[model samples]
Target: MANLLVTGAAGFIGTNFVRYWLEHYPEDRLVGLDALTYAGCRRNMDALRHYQQFQFIHGDIGHYENICQILREQQIDTLVHFAAESHVDRSIHGPDTFIQTNILGTHSLLKAAKTVWLDEQPGLIHRFHHVSTDEVYGSLGPEDPPFSETTPYAPNSPYSASKAASDHLVRAYHHTYGLSTTVSNCSNNYGPYQFPEKLIPLMLVNILNNKPLPVYGDGLNVRDWLYVEDHVRGIEKILSAGIVGEVYNIGGNNEWKNIDIVHLLCQEMDRAFAERSELAARYPLAPPANGQPSTSLITYVRDRLGHDRRYAINANKMAYWLNFNPDIAFASGLRKTIAWYLDNESWWRELLARAAP
Candidate 1:
């Protein structure tokens, strides 16, 4: 059993991973480190507090001394990097944090890994697994094939650019310095504990509250969606069996247009609300789409600057190399996601309150 340092363990995907890892590998010890940034919520990881094998560190990955000390003390044999400034819109307004965290912070962690794991124990097996995004491949035309492991980097936005740079750094460390590493660039993920600012949770919350559902541009942009739990499974697969010094692209093979997803979500919200509302007395029979249904909440807005048109991942390599398969269908995943947000009103409410102006 490995002692793992999981950076950004308080964030959406990281929290899911921590719980998943602990549940599956009860013997392994996990050290979760997060700075609790705006996007990193401590409550996301509250359950892990009771797990004796899991410990949460209130720390930053960017700080070299802090990371080196942790690596040395915890005897971290593996590092799973999940920290970053991930929002594209936020990156457009502010790129500094992305550079500082995704790029520089990655460097610091790599340096610490090299020092504690490599320098001290020269012959020990170590892994630095970087969780990245498919956005680094940039946009694809309607007819373009999905992005493959060997696809050329064509990052479009500040967020993707930062991730691309970080990917390069990981590759460089593997080749030039021989630090064993694996990078998996995954498609968009959705499920429990996602910050409401994201499309799925945001639309769900808005629909329940009867607020306007903002759709960017014509909402025709397409994305490959992976359920969050399925993604955590993929990460575990990579860490256990992925070849060192190789990059893997994890895709759900589930693609949908933004508008289509919103429409479906609207309909699902109507169904969910119908079951919960005693005052409205309109639960089972969904309201007409033309009436004041959730779909009616859709309001078209300006498209994001430098928004990519489409993102589809070619996971054939992951399939062949690791037998990785995404089991959750989009319809089932969407329904489950909506149910989660509906049941966890206090969770989203408190997070939104903390983010309020």
Candidate 2:
């Protein structure tokens, strides 16, 4: 059984990964560490408390000594590094935090892993998997081929730039210091437990509250959307069989324009309300309850600064080598995400209240 340390365990994708790990690897000892930032909700891990083999630590990944201590104490042989400042808009407004957390924080973790797993206990079986985004590949044109593992780095925003630096650091560590590391650059991820700041969740919440659905630019920006669960599975495949020094691209192969996604979501919302009478009472402010289409709330807004026009990931490497592929269809995944938010109203409501100024 692999003793594992998962950073950002309280955040969206991290939370799902933690749950998946615990459920599938019951015999493995797992420890989750999180700084509990605005996006890293402590409540997200409340359900995992019942597991005897899991432990949660409230801490930041920026602290080097603390990470060293955790690595040594937990005897952690597998470290899945997921902690980072990931919001593009927030990073654009305030880049200092992104630089600190994404670049410096990742450096600190690498240092700790090297000190504990390499210098102190050489030949100790281990793997350090770093999670990253495809934004580092910059924008793609309508006719451009999707980004592959070999795609050159051309980051646009502060968030993507910071992540690109960290990705380089991980690669450097593997090549220079012989650290057992692998990197996966994934496309957009959407699923349950995702913070409302993201596109899908933001649109869903606004549709429920009868607020305007803000679409950036012409809402024509295209992205490959991978469900969080499929992304997690891709990571597991990398850990199980991927080469230590190689990079993998994980994608859903489902590219949807921004406005088209919003429109589809609106249609799904309308269907939900029409099929279930209880939804109308639960979200009375929603346009669906008042016999109006959720599309009525669509309101175009200025596009984000340094916004990349499109991002598509070519996961041929992951499929050909690791035998991995995303199983969830876009419609099925979207429906599940919407149902999750509606059933767990208290969760998102509390997060919204906390985020309110």
Candidate 3:
């Protein structure tokens, strides 16, 4: 059985990925490391307690020595790096954390991996997979093609810039130091266990509470959305069959305008509340509970600073090389996501409470 180390294992995508890995590779021992920052919730991984082979470590990736010790002790054959300061608004407000965590933290992890996997055990079979985003390609025009592996780096936000720097370091490690590494840049992801700060969850929560659903600018900015499970499958394909030192773009090929997505969520929430009689009592604050449309809560707000107009990914490389493509459609995925939040009220409620200042 393979031993794997997954950083950022308490965050949205990382939590999902860790659960996915344990479920599929129950024989494989997995160590999950997270700094447990605001976005990284330890409770998100509570379900993982059932997996005897899985362990969670509350530690910052910025510490190189700690990482080295973990690698050496765990005998981790694979390191999946996912830790990053991902929220755009937060990055704009506090760029220093982004730089420290995304850039320096990644470098520290790389160094630790190099020390343990390459230097200490020269011939060890190891893979260092760096998870990244499509924002590094900067904004795309209305007619611009989707971002590909060959796309040039033109990061517009502090978050994306830090990610770009980390991506460069991963590349350098693979090329300059001959580390067995692969990078996958994915599009937007949405599904269960997602923190409410993101667009989809935020809208869902606000609609449930009758709070204003803030839509940025005219809300026409576009983004490709990938289901969380499909992203896990794509990452599995890369780890299994992908070429070392190569980059793959994972996308759902599902593009939607921000306003359109908000409207869709409103409609879905209304539909759910209409079909479920008990939902009215559970979420009494919702507009649907009062026989009003959830759409009534939509409120246009000021645009974010340096918000990318569009971001799309070209996953042809993943398809051609790894035979991987996202499976869940936007409609089906949205329904599942809505159902998750509605059913797991306690989970989200506790999360919101803890996150509250």
Say which candidate scores most in lDDT: 2
Which TM-score value belongs to model 1?
0.96
The C-alpha TM-scores of every prediction are: 0.96, 0.99, 0.99
- Each candidate: what lDDT? 0.90, 0.95, 0.94
Candidates ranked by TM-score, best first?
2, 3, 1
Which window of ten consecutive residues has the lowest lDDT sum in model 1?
A: 282-291
Question: In candidate 2, which residue pairs get closer than 3 Å at backbone N, Cα or C atoms, i.e. clash?
Answer: none
Is 1 or 3 the stronger prediction by TM-score?
3
lDDT of 2 by residue, 176-245 (tens): 9899999999999999999999999999999999999999999999999999999999999999999999
Candidates 1 and 2, the one with greater TM-score: 2
lDDT (10s digit) by residue, model 1, range 94-128: 99999999999999999988888778889888999
Cα displacement (angstroms), candidate 1, residue 304, comes to 0.6
lDDT, candidate 2, at 118: 96
Model 3 residue 311 CA deviation (Å) reads 0.8
lDDT score of model 3?
0.94
